[model samples]
Target: MKTGEKVVLAYSGGLDTSVIIPWLKEKYDCEIIAVCIDVGQGEETHAIKKKAISSGASKVYVEDVVEEFVTDYIYPTLKAGAIYEGKYLLGTSFARPLMAKKLVEIAHQEGANVIAHGCTGKGNDQVRFEVSIKALDPSIKIIAPWRIWEIKSREEEITYALKKGIPISITKEKIYSVDKNIWHISHEGGNLENPWNEPKPELFDMVTPPEKAPDVAEYVSIEFEKGIPVKINGEELSPVELIKKANEIASIYGVGIADIVENRLVGMKSRGVYETPGGTLLYTAHKELESLVLDKETLRFKDIVAQKYADLVYNGLWFSQLKESLDAFVDETQKVVTGVVKLKLYKGNIIIAGLSSPYSLYNEELATFGEDKIYDQKDAEGFINLFGLPLKMRAYQMKHFVENQKYNKTTVGGEQ
Candidate 1:
């Protein structure tokens, strides 16, 4: 690549990305266009722009992608009932593709051949960012400073930043690696790296302590249209808006706190403390809705697909065709899942308040235990007889064969 070619750097106003802007400029002697995709980072974007400029970037592109992040990425996973390995909601996984896409866009716009991110060599973010970039624009030269550069650790990077006179936002004392988005905020590293250590309560941003949650139960209604959340408290919203609204409501109830030890794609178990209060609430409500609308066989079959779907999303195969096909199946099943789920949130528990669906298959009179002429009690006798026909026939044949071994269907030890 040309030495002076423009490059788009994925910039967070944090220590790693802040230091990366100047590092990119000096190492390659190229124009650095810092691209920050706002996936609900919950801060003023302009400040990040200023930070990027001070760190030696020629330009800054802070794109508002919360809507896209929620609708295209978060909502689809919600509809699929995707929880990675039945625990993780994949807060960080969902944001990476959208950010990488934006990076590719800015790189092409700047006529830049190179793109870089602050993802560490040891983490999953590098895989997420690089895979997405290669999938979107394979021609773009990927520069991963963490993988190649001599910055051995975060401490070294901090010292480098100080020596270069670059203003850094992170401190040595508070060094928990964090990724924030509208869906959730995840905390890893530091004390959390050890499974024996309980997550620090102060690490939470979106939730109150479950113990501090309301003593009395709080109720809320969510309306779904074809398995997708469309209305919250009767206010219609886009997918993104619905999740954001849910996030606000659920956070108040101290919902969506997940501390999991999960296996990474690179084959190592890692621990993360996650806060996805809205996602937690949404997941519970949607499953309840499906239980009402779906038949027993369909629900069981969908579960098998759900596992695969979860794997696909977690493994960053969102753009794959298999995921598309599974999504189609999920969408078709969701046609009858249009309804409202009222949930009673008390402490850390989500109790079902009520559920009503337009396509509800509940036949109360038939299911009732009361005596009815239409339902014959003796009918079970014949039904059970038919159901056990094969077993009965085998038993009868064996009984006769055992009794008359010499006249058996086949000679026993040549005795016939």
Candidate 2:
């Protein structure tokens, strides 16, 4: 906590981070090393560096982490089928750990023991960032401005920025806090605070409105290898390029938009609108492929794992042992989940058109409605009897007990 010590900050060149650069200098009198981990938010690196330096940062590092994010964070979560609260695709949740890891790496490189972030005390990112940093390096000091700083409310922060002569694009009227990456974009705050308020059309960035989507349904085929999307419409692409292509195609037809009132890790309910164009397509295709290949029991158990995995990611326990174990389970299940799934995208609907896989467990001979050599119709009679034995026995026991009660009542009445 000494003055003039180098402190690495997780910078975004946004309003909160822009203000933090000067505030850190004024309060701690420490040298601020601004590090922006780019996870495909589409930020201009040169502009961010310029702004960071202008705002009193001694040095700047804009680390490009898009490819690592997709292959490491996103694909694993996708393969696990982890959807937070059945709606959030975990766009912001999974991105934070990677960003924090990069921050810690830079902090080590700079020989700084302290790290800072722009995450607020009220939201989930603070937990995500701090926890991941602690997990990575327990010795790094974390400075969370929102928890300790006196300047509260975005309005007050704006005033402080003006007083400090810092450049910020956010205004009081358009104060929606947004988080964007290649996987998804999330919009919170502003009027979205109210659950009943319909999200304004202008708030959406990645997806077209379902009503505004094209009249013609477009068919797209996605091929997967071991549960990771590898191709689109018969064309092979790198992980990053595949996601971009999926986003481009699915966004046009308004594929992935989720408005959710979810339970935050901080014991509060929050409303957020998420746009995950390509992610939606990928998730749908991967699930269909799993259905084609995985057995009923493994698929059912994976659903359980999916919910727990989603909770761990949402609660910022990405480095926890349970999550690592679950990842192993998910990976084992995905070994046979290689296939091509064709889907029809129209007006925000993803309907399965066709599914093909060499590892498919679905057998037409056993499942056929007409004549089938492998399956005997009479076999179901014995199977049903075995499957429903407990129910049948319980029903019979109830019937006999009722008749015995009636007989006992009649005998008692006659004796009276």
Candidate 3:
């Protein structure tokens, strides 16, 4: 709260965070260090430093955690096969903890006592940022301006920024809360609030419209080692390059697009349009490879674990003990998940062309219906009887009971 105190802000160079610089300066009268964690925002990070300084930050630090994000956060969620509400790829969910982690690191590096974020009071990100900070460093204080600031809406924030001479890029006409990373781009607010309204063409940046995609189906082959994507079309790539290439290819065919009304952690149903071109492809490839290697029971149980994993990530409990334990189980399943999956991308539909694994459970010899040396036709007789023993006893009991009732029927008056 003192003038000389240092505070590290989770800066995005967006309207909210851009305004937050001066707001913090005026409110707390503290020296602000704007920390922008670049998780593959592409060109969005170009003017971040200049913008932060212009908005009243004493210093700016832009940290690129793209490779760490993909390997640490994205791949773990992918290996667990977690999809929120059966559709959401959790583009915004998983990115929060990693970003918050970086904010804490920067806060410590800057020797700042307080870490600040621009997440609004109504959204899940506030919880995501705060909980993650608490998990890593409990002694560090957090300043959330959205809960304390008098500004009520985006328009109000813009007006406040203009009045304070804080330079910002957002205008009333182009107002949409966007969160972008290596994995996906999420669009919320604006016309997206109305679920019935179709997403405007201009809203689409990462993925094209499905109808506008090429008529010819494009095939892509992905190779996985220990459940992490190792190659694309037989070419090895780094963690960052793999996601980048997959995004490029899948976006061309409009491969990933989901418009859903998801239940937010704030107890409200919020409609969001997500474009996870690369992530969708990777999830499909990884899952297909798992099917080939993992047995039925393990896959089925993993499906249940996947749902819970999704909830933990979505709810911002990524650092919890339960999630760590689930990761252990998920990693055990991925040990044999090394394989290659070929997929056909056509108008946003990912069709599995082929799948193969060294540990594949698909054995043609034992599965053949025709005469096989490994299996005896007569062996099915005893196996079927044993498997259906309960059903056979129940049928016999019902038959005998019906026959006895027919011969010795008792009426309500006790007549037989």
State each model's CA lDDT, in order.
Answer: 0.86, 0.95, 0.92
- The list of candidate 3 runs beyond 4 A from truth reads 44-46, 397-416
Q: Name the TM-score of candidate 2.
A: 0.98
Full-model lDDT, candidate 2: 0.95
- RMSD to the true structure for each prediction, in A, is 2.9, 1.0, 1.8
Tens digits of per-residue lDDT, candidate 1, 226-280, equal: 8888888889988777888888888887788889998888788899988998899
Estimated TM-score per prediction? 0.92, 0.98, 0.96
- lDDT per residue (tens digit) for residues 73-137 in model 3: 99999999999998899888898999989988888888898999999999999999999999999
For candidate 2, write residues 1-416 as lDDT tens digits.
99999999999998899999988998999999999999999999999999999999999999999999999999999999999999999999999999999999999899999999999999999999999999999999999999999988999999999998988899999999999999999999999998889999999899999999999999999999998999999999999999999999999999999999999999999999999999999999999899999989999999999999999999999999999999999999999989899999999999999999999888988888889888878888999999999999999999999999999999999999
Q: Which ten residues in a row have the lowest lDDT in candidate 2?
A: 368-377
Measured with C-alpha atoms, the lDDT of residue 416 in candidate 1 is 44
lDDT of 1: 0.86
Q: What is the lDDT of residue 103 in candidate 1?
A: 89
Clashing residue pairs in candidate 1 (N, C-alpha, C atoms within 3 angstroms): none
Best by TM-score: 2
Scanning candidate 3 in windows of ten residues, the lowest lDDT window is 407-416
**Candidates in descending TM-score order:** 2, 3, 1
Cα error, candidate 3, residue 281 (Å): 0.7
